[model samples]
Target: MNAFRTTRWSLIAAARDSPSRAQAALDQLCQAYRPPVLAFIRHSGYGNDAEDLTQAFFLRFIERGWYAEADPQRGSFRALMLTALRRFLSDQYERAGALKRGGRTVESGSLLEVIASDGQSPEDAFMRAWMGTVLEHAMQRLEEEWSSAGKLDQFRQLAPLLLERAEGDELRAIAVANGLRTNTLAVQTHRMRQRLRQLVRLELLQTVGSPEALERELAELRGALDEMT
Candidate 1:
């Protein structure tokens, strides 16, 4: 019922409606999440090849319609992405001499350098991966909640317009579309905003191991979104 949960559910519902759009949304989500994923891959000790492989895994997720298989009832999006990443790494390890090699010449810098820029240890890298997994799960929960409530369709139609227009214009449009009075629409919008915040907090609760961890994780989530902007 928090903002994060609402956003997460909205996205899941959107994804369920259209795979292409879902992928686009997922790509946007990944931009916030990729650094941690990359750090995990690097800490696991794969070379730059592994980094490229990690990027390719995301690309494949879209190209193959991977999100279509995501089931919020079964598990979280965070678990799914990390599971896929682990599988990809496992398959790559099976390739000839993949694990035996030292640093082979890569186009970009070493994966380790990318992951350990601030003297980060392998444990730090692992924590990053854990965080990414947690956030992804939170997103999935939000999506499921919205889809169940059947407001996802309305949200999708109005989100872009509302984001662009002034409050009066947005209220007018929403009121007309939903067959509500302007005052009623305004109240609905306020409720919707409240729901979004609640959803976000719910998601944050699931991701962080404890209440003390929530503040830091929330800050990181905000920072990740800011980076996208």
Candidate 2:
């Protein structure tokens, strides 16, 4: 298993065994999930202060050791994170309302009126963002791997086909353009897809506690991505 996958509950253990290593793991997770966190906050009507709020939320999360309460048996890390973020936003809203009641001026733009035009809850929006980010990171790692092997151009040309359907004629055209046989191109694309799946699983594994949880998360990821299409 990758050192990065030794996170979540393992991270809490690390805090006891090695605080520095645990902190590094926490930082990596925060960076990876920042986009989804921001999406949730913005969708919750904190668009104006999303950046500051995200930063502060992360600071509080880490400084207060809130993640120490994460129990793998209860749920995946993603669930734990979303729950914490929702609570944080609720507290922020309550604080602003209290200030207003106390005759303190709360910035008008601090909390915009939530307009969920798509009828998507903030939780749903956050999951979509998380799914997208996972794929983005997986693709990035795929590119780096192929690039290091001197096949960056091949990876680039075939990457789109990995995620989208292409007719036989189109596949042949792509193969011919690259001076390769259609069958060979098909094999290469299959390999690429397999590699991508492995990378995506690795990415998801960091947030899961066990193999069962990993499978569950991967299924959820696939379902979420399918919904997007």
Candidate 3:
């Protein structure tokens, strides 16, 4: 059921419904992928123009109603989005200089900021931005879950264990501060990791069109993580 709950279909349905109801899902999809798309544009050598192009690209993609007719069966949403982005860039490149990019700009130091300036490959920059945004999505959800449960501080204490390597001394100190034994802290961190894993999968599920596709994406995600290390 989660497979079809993908934003690909949601945006499609929203488009078919009415313009007013369509923006929410469309906005969500655009916002989730914006960082990577912007990174791609940045690495393509647009520099200061990437931010403007990012907004313009999204506005074109949605306002043009391209996604409403997009066939998710033809390809993954990731592939489709990238393809759309490339097309947007190609069409806009010649006009970029003439387009006047003085509109809204990206804030200070986003994931895509200075990606191209850092001597990173376009593919690497895009992947870094993609993974970063996905992790941000999952972290935000976990934070919300903990906040809703009134365990935000506990989650904060354990979050580092899941997302980053916490030193043994630090973990033990956290345990002592939280009134938990070392073993109890270990168990809680394990549970929190499990929850984080589930949330990550949930985020991935939204990007896939089917259960089989989701499984394939999950396998690719693991491979990507492995390669990152």
Candidate 4:
């Protein structure tokens, strides 16, 4: 939220001294970007071979102190991560022959069976995966919140209307199904939509380094969604 508030993400700042804290921050960063990174590797032509490389890249990324180079003044975390991932892949292909996943050592393969060459670049694959991850996080937060309140059934009934433009008749039908008045259901749908936006904003904030960058990040997300469709 605030600069002082976000100082805790100083996981990198404490990294040279505190290994545990640095690992925590690295884990947070990886959790946010892992989906898109892996998808980009896959679309780059590695197919399932991308999985092991993805894991190896992350291990090298944190273990090698790459987070120390994060320059918020330069760009979004997306750009930084992609740049690092590209470098990691290049290095892997250049020096290393195989990557270790768990106990098994898997060898990297060539781009033979292309998965996303249908008019989409690696950036497109990253955007698709990132957007899907964002939506999934929002839906999960919404469900957990509703479930914790013991109103999961209410969330279920209101989810469809919240996501789509439903007619009055359809709203009424959903209201009847949930034993709720049409007016009540409509109001709940509005609130649910508001909550969804809040969840999305919170999730987006985890990637953006500051509150000021949030709107721009959201615009990027919107652009990504538009391109994806």
Candidate 5:
């Protein structure tokens, strides 16, 4: 069937599985969601410890049967994940003096590290963490849609545009370089924006049970973005 339809079904199937199946589903979901979560953690002041903490959180989440407590009727997955991360951070901070550092550090690191090392505040770090999570969720859904539709390469080609803001001249230059007319590039940009919005909505839907939840999430995302600026 269609990729969009498949994504919808996959989400439902994943949510309704038996224990073993649920674990598999959660694994896939985590794979899709982990990068942004890691970025968020790193931005939230965890630094080199982010990856290890993120992994530990997931391990404990599963071992503690956390997924079984997921209440789709109450909140979006993003919110729940953020809440989990917040609790993890609080606990880690309280035990910071006692906890021994372990695990391989992320070599390439995240954008948050660059921002923090530049002397950004903890509030900035918090907002960046949220922004990274939202962006990651949006990108993951977009990638999944593209992969399912067999247009993964096309999406990859447009990845830069997806990640950053584009000026009109810059977009025109890219269009010309790619052998496309400016008007065509404009349309493509519009489509990309729409897809991004849709991806965000799809993610919100997974955590939220209704349109109102999506609205709330969009507002939160916007607020976080504003904080970064």
Candidate 6:
């Protein structure tokens, strides 16, 4: 199958044609991106209302069929989601009084309306949270792979180095504790890191439309992680 057809955004784009598949895609999307959404909402100062706002955002995104407007040629799935979220937040801000009074009001608006861009973008805290979620999901997959291969303990032992956070002394101690030579531990760490990169790439690929977009998203992910550290 063509790569684009397998993307979550592609399933979302098929909302009008395949409601069941599109519904499944929406479920997966909400599950994976909920953390980022909550982070963004809280960072935007929603605080205690973040959970409600996040739920409302996804509800509108699904019931309103906003995903159908996603344009692959414009950017990656992350960008598409962020744009919609910005619009939704802007709409909410316009109705702050109702929201502050503990009332939920999601107004209908055309996705085509030009949302003014400012320094506060989805690329701010949202991008950082999204990248963290991506890395976490990739690591979870790596852990699953290692567990299935009966190397779960090894993976857990060497993961600090794989994440580039292990000190040489710490790694050496772990190697000695595991009854392995430091050189063998080093080799295992290198292989695990390479496998992790591959898993991260696969995770990004499923949400991106093209190779170029994948590269761009990967670069952004790296930059976001750097900012977080």
Q: Which one is best on lDDT?
A: 2
| Candidate closer to the true structure by lDDT (higher is better), 1 or 3 | 3
The deviation in Å at residue 124 for candidate 2 is: 1.0
Task: For residues 1-229, write the lDDT of model 6, one tens digit per residue.
Answer: 2667766666676664676665676677788899888777766656556788888888788778777767676778787778788888888776765654676653333112332243344456787678778899999999999899998887787777877767788878999978998888888888889999999898898787777888988887877777756
Q: What CA RMSD would candidate 5 show?
A: 6.7
lDDT of each: 0.59, 0.80, 0.74, 0.74, 0.65, 0.76
List, residue by residue over 86-200, the lDDT tens digit for candidate 5. 7766776655534334443434442134444656554455456555665687897788888999978767767678667778888888787768888887788679878897776
Model 6, residue 103: C-alpha shift (Å): 14
lDDT of 1 by residue, 1-229 (tens): 3433444435555666777686776666667567767776776665656667667777765666555666544544455566776766566555433534654543333333344455555435645565555545544554566679897876665444422444787668777888888887667666655655566566655433345555665776567555544
The number of the candidate with the highest TM-score is: 2
Model 4 spans > 4 angstroms off: 1-17, 21-32, 96-118, 167-170
- Clash pairs for candidate 4: none
Q: List TM-scores for all candidates, in order.
A: 0.43, 0.85, 0.82, 0.79, 0.64, 0.81
In candidate 3, what are the lDDT values of residues 1-229, reduced to their tens digit? Answer: 4447546566766765687866676677677788998888888767666788788887887777767656655556766677788778777654543443645444343223445557776666677788788788899999999999999988887887897767889989999989999889988888888888888777776666676777887777678667766
Clashing pairs in 5: 75-207, 76-207, 76-208, 77-207
- lDDT score, residue 147, model 6? 95
**Candidate 1 residue spans exceeding 4 A from truth:** 1-19, 96-124, 129-229
CA RMSD (A), model 1: 11.4
Q: Which ten contiguous residues of candidate 1 have the minimum total lDDT?
A: 105-114
Question: Worst lDDT window (10 residues) for model 6?
Answer: 107-116
Which of 1 and 3 is the better model by TM-score? 3
Q: What TM value does model 3 have?
A: 0.82
Clashes of 5: 4
The 10-residue segment of model 4 with minimum total lDDT is 1-10
lDDT score of residue 229 within candidate 5: 74
Each candidate: RMSD? 11.4, 2.8, 5.3, 4.8, 6.7, 6.0
